[model samples]
Target: MELLERLFMGSPALWGGGVAHSVLILALVVALGIMLGKIRVAGVSLGVTGILFVGIAFGWYGMNVDGHLLHFLKEFGLILFVYSIGLQVGPGFFSSFRKGGVTLNKVAVLAVLLGVGTTVALYCLTGLPMTTLVGVMSGAVTNTPGLGAAQQAFSDLHAGAEAPDIATGYAVAYPLGVVGAILTLAALRYLLRVDTQREEREAGSGTDALKDLTTRRISVEVCNPAIEGMSIAQLRELALREFVISRICRAGGEPELAGADTKLHGGDRVLVVAAPRDIEALVALMGREAADTPLMRDRKMISRRILITKSELNGKQLADLKVRSTCGVTITRINRAGIDLVAAGSLQLQIGDRVTVVGPELSVAHAERLFGNSLRRLDHPNLIPIFIGIALGVVLGSISFWIPGVPQPVKLGLAGGPLVVAILIGRYGPHYKLVTYTTMSANLMLREVGIALFLAGVGLGAGEDFIPTLLAGGYVWIAYGAAITVVPLLLAGLWGRLRYKLNYYTLIGVLSGASTNPPALAYCSEQTQTDAPSVGYATVYPLSMFLRVLAAQLLILMFG
Candidate 1:
């Protein structure tokens, strides 16, 4: 340790090395970040590797010094990253909240509590010091973000103002964080084997509700035509008391959402949800030339269902089986590669294929009885709105960088400014595309590399003085890391069961931020039915992302 330390301290690299050692460390980390971004990932790899490289490189090639500047960058970068996350999550987050954010909150709170409690308890009992405690806490939460907060807390309490020896301490405890996270995930999946779709499955569909409840609908025609000349807001407000408009279809166009701001025209078909019998009564009042809202479209409604080619059902051509005759429904079209099938009797049904069916509303119910949860309708036209929202988010985030009053050299969040802006853009942007959901994957490796390098820088700069308590009290770190995993795993299991019996593997992903897995969710989603694994995944995943960034700093601060 002494020899290497001396050699790294600009002890001349046999040639003209001198001050170049420090520069080389920085370059290496930067190079690693570049390589990870360009070679490893196509996108979203920037923040992960870039941040990691910068973080770790500090420990390896840095000199122990007060890095006020670098500290500011780190702090600001993290905040920007967090703020962007908050913005992106804001829109749907509220929706999720209305549905059941309470359960999510409880689990998150428990996670942080487990981190803190484990550390404090272990510190008192094992005398493992605070640095390791921070690392353990970070590992348990799978929240790197909390690490910074915890570290700050520890430094304030024990080491006056000068931070602990972050080099050796961070290096040692980092492994613990990685290992601890891995173990907790493994244990949860092993014990619980959860799935969230069961309850939702029991909740009957809106179609059934439509049939059961007597619906009242009103229709109005306008010739004004702005987009047609009907004001969506006015029409909606006009009908607010009696009905909620469901959809509006123009001649030869996709149906527009009811509340869309298009003007009404003479032929525009407006569909409203209300009492089934009151249609004639409302129409009677507005008569003469105009009619009350009571017009049903004659076009056949499309049924949305997922059809997979299970080996048990292979080699059967559509014409041969007469699925319509046998199942009381007809296939509207098949969506194999793209384009829905309007006429596909001759097309053979292959394994792993999908089909869309349409038939009588009763036939749909009958089909379910025959096919089980195997078929459904592709009905939510609101998907377009999601994509629109995402685009807007990205624009907003990108423009923020160019905002007039914003600081020029500011680090937006994770990877300076631009990347943070991008994260927010995607996360917050209104129109969300499922394909673009993973758009950030390209920079994932870059972000990791940056963080590693930055850590190395910190380690190199802090040198060895960061470790006074560590030399004084050695066993504290082991206790801290050990307790982090134990407490969090217990809490996750308890919380998972209490909340919704969330699928075990997905819950692990939530707790640990292991989004890319060994086909856990996909396989499970296929096996059990319903995309319920994703609910558990998405519920806690956002928080986990922020936590992952902060956890790194906390480990360094507490254990260093």
Candidate 2:
């Protein structure tokens, strides 16, 4: 019994209380939580959030660890998680906001307002303390930053007596907040009788530009006399689409790699690499269908995935770079993040974009040099921008703005500041000579590690008193918290779907974003088997998070 206790709790007599003990407890909690989280019931899983419950359990068992270390890990983990998310969505964030983003954000704001209204109603009905109600509000949304902001506001207002209630209410309500959002998503799916495959097909059909990016190789014979003497560049201009002429073979001549300036003849057979949808257009403009010949099999021609690591190339359009005219290479496609983009002349290059360039071996090599395709450089983390972003976020979080009729000023807080800053850096950093690109593996690693640390810390900190609080009158707040969590989500989510005709996947994402629940977003993504939910989540996240924090404080000030 003593040995088991010492192993789980660490003995002061043997391995004195320090970082090692803290690390040991954290590792155990995270490992167990991850394994436990994978246990699915009705096709739903808690994911990494299982770590928090495990931490709470350990803390409930009277396990002691370093307090300061736990605090540091918790905050640092949150910073890492939000910052990584910011970087991941940063490139598309602005563009996303421009397209149907305004309406989605408005829906998200309505959801936030609905949630705040629910919390206020719960407070009035239950006669709960304002601090406890605010905590429940934060937990209902699964937003730690909101809770922190509320606590900060409480402290600023000298309502320290209600502070303990905040944490207790938060702990009791948090688990269900995570579960409730997922449940709301599930309920909507069933209620709406949503067909997942049909939704995917519908969404897919709507994105024509993305669908048109599929690379296809087609051969055409130059039967048109007008196009016979035209250069490849002139033909490309006439076609009015982004396709590449890779090789040309004239009567009684061997196939040779084609360049933008290469001239065509009446009998020439040309191999064009372009989207399948654009093939008919090109064929109509250029010539008739020709026999399939292995034109691309030229020994001197090569195709390589060139990574854009050079800052100078970042944010510059392909037309500006003129790789086709300058290096005689054709960029068939560009892979950004995980999305494949057809390499159009107007397509702007971002750092870390992998462009598939095809041309003569010499030309391809020159394009590679221009792009700085350095595998070693990609492995090194760009620490300067990361730290600078975090520093700026902290400063931004610390500043407060006074509001009319409010007792305390509202601040962006840690999560909001870093998130907002990272989004800007991800979108505009390239313009300012800052490389905000990170490899997928690195970004995922940082995000996972950060969330894990954060969950562990929260669980450990709240665990010690979790059970006691729950058993002693804190238990009722769970029901109150659940009400706060589900009411707003269901109301707003259903409204968006029924009125706005939002796609089920996108609606789920909007609910998750409005709630600021990562677990819900993860579940929605898994259920839909698409990243579409992520788009909705990312688009509304910054604004939702800010509103949540502000609303939490407003709740405290109004009712306290």
Query: Which candidate's lDDT is highest?
Result: 2
Tell me how candidate 2 scores on lDDT: 0.78
Taking the tens digit of each residue's C-alpha lDDT, what string does model 2 give over 1-560?
98877777777776776677789899999999999889987756667768878888988887757878877787788788878877887876665454366667777999999888888787778888888888888877888767666665665567433265676677678778888888878998888898989988654443322223235677898888888689988987887887877678888887776777899988889887776567788898777888755575567677889999887888888888877777888777777655455677777789999998878888999998989998787888888889999999888877888778876666666666787788889988977778899888899998889889877886877787777777888888888888888888888877887777777777788789899898898888887665667767776776787678678767776676
lDDT of 1 by residue, 37-65 (tens): 34422211232334343434445345322
- TM-score: model 2 vs. ground truth: 0.74
lDDT of each: 0.43, 0.78
What local lDDT score does residue 304 receive in model 2, on the 0 to 100 scale? 89
What TM-scores do the predictions have? 0.47, 0.74
Per-residue lDDT, model 1, residue 435, is 17
